[model samples]
Target: MMFNIELKDVGKSYGDNEVLRDIDFSVDKGSFTAIVGKSGCGKSTLLRVIAKLEETSKGTLTFSGEGSKDPKIRIMFQDDRLIPWKNILSNISIGAVNKAAAKESLQEVGLIDKEKDWPDQLSGGQKQRIALARALASNPDILLFDEPLGALDALTRMEMQNLIEELWQQQQFTSLLVTHDVTEAVTLANRVIVIDKGTIQLDEKIDLPRPRERDEKFTYYEKKILNQILGG
Candidate 1:
């Protein structure tokens, strides 16, 4: 079967500063993949490169199968990135303004009632929910999440994690998440890619079932991933 995303010997640099080197990977259709690494390891940079927000210094990226023309890609970031001037509905719509689609996306994130409220008036969790709704409203073929829950508190982070998992299952969209949280990656991803010093150190299958609990088994896998990332 053909893969949905393919990156062959990809690399990137800023003048003399090389940020990524000879990276390679592929993602199957409907798969959820996570990239984790320490700060400045080029995890987010890889996501940006894949999303075409940043051009690669070398190599090729290929998107296959249906929806390849436009790809309907969406990105959610660490910050909510919502406009303070826009209300929740407008923020979610982002000028698409399909009332039915906006309503459905907001309801999916449990923010349907806050449509009239300004972004500044929502809680951190709600702001993130709006971000999620915005991403979903686009009906993306692939969702690129760059530390989307990094700013939330523990409880909110857990909630958002569950929400993302649920949404992924419901939407069946291919996803690539760039996160520093090992447990979060384990919980949400079917495969985890570990990058270090501008290189991919490990690309391992999670093999864990969906709705994974943070029990001993999950903890073990988390430790193993941490060790791989840290070169332990």
Candidate 2:
């Protein structure tokens, strides 16, 4: 019960296609974990299984936290996926019941003033910020990210990374990120798990401390994971 989430012998398959196999991991409450793998390696499918967007073909997932039978969960993805027709504030408010909390979430993402603007009116980074604010508005105890920064430019991506770390530090939520970037994985997570060919290849702890500088300091773990993915 100490763990917020646990996967026991989890597996997923679409007809004959096996996406994940014997996946087993437990995420402690308030921990940040990153999952990395090559394209078509079932990374997204694994995340979807956690989200319950897709049912597991085998095994069980257990969740416990905050004295509630079910923990509140939310997911952020690469697309930002905002409603183009709805203005920024409305998008969040519609999804989140409390309008005041939606406003505060926008403020947390530094988008309080753009509440009335359409999604198309914002830049890519700003749009992603809105998406993040919407996710946070619900105050989910469990948050999942699927390459949320994959589409951003370098500078903006770094900014978003900082935002994520800052928010995680402030809110202490259990976070799971699925990313292809090894550097991003090392920079953001307390633990990094690498997947290959529908199985776990490596699950390593990132010993580096938070507010981590993306300098040569993280090269050791980054290269370790990179080599794992490259089959070196």
Candidate 3:
């Protein structure tokens, strides 16, 4: 019962289109994992299936842990998905039990000052922070990210990455990120999974120390994953 999530022979399909097949993995509690692959390679589909946003067509998806029969799971996306009409505070408070919890989450993202500001007034990166705050407000046991930083400019993206890593280190929530950027995957995840043609091609453990650099070892793993994805 130590694992937070497990998939056994999982499969997903839309009629004749098979998006994921024979997927098998177990996510350790409080671990960070990244899934990467080319466009249309079903990486996102795997996350969706695990998140129950899309039901699997075959096999079992199990949730187990101490008091995890009905675990709290949250997902963040690249779109930021904020409600334009609501102010920053209210947006993150959507599922929160109280304004205090929402405020704490907002503060965690370093956006407490923007509480009363509308979503339109905030920049793209700020909006995404609010999105992350909203996801964190629920105190999720598992957090899934579907390319949440894809829309940001380079510097902002790196900033968000740092913020995310800091928060993850502090909170120790189980995380799964689906990203097209191998560097992003290598930088954040303790383990990186490469998917091709709807199945996992390489599952590499990133033994590099945290606050990881794009050092030689980092580049080696990055190139290995890239080669796997590109069929090099």
Give the lowest summed-lDDT range of ten residues in model 3. 1-10
Would you estimate the TM-scores of all the predictions?
0.96, 0.96, 0.97
Prediction 3 TM-score vs. true: 0.97
- lDDT per residue (tens digit) for residues 10-94 in model 1: 9999999999999998899789999999999999999999899999999998888753445767899999999998788988888
* Model 2 regions lying over 4 Å from their true place: 1-3, 215-217
lDDT of 3 by residue, 141-202 (tens): 88999999998999999999999999999998889999999999999999999999889899
TM-score of 2: 0.96
lDDT for predicted candidate 1 compared with the true structure: 0.89
Return the candidate ranking by TM-score, descending.
3, 2, 1
Best-performing candidate as measured by lDDT: 3
**Residue 206 in model 1: lDDT:** 88
Q: Rate the local accuracy (lDDT) of all candidates.
A: 0.89, 0.91, 0.92
- The number of clashing residue pairs in each candidate reads 0, 0, 0
* Better model by lDDT: candidate 2 vs candidate 3: 3
lDDT of 1 at 215: 81
Q: Rank the candidates by lDDT, best first.
A: 3, 2, 1
> Of 1 and 2, which scores higher on lDDT?
2
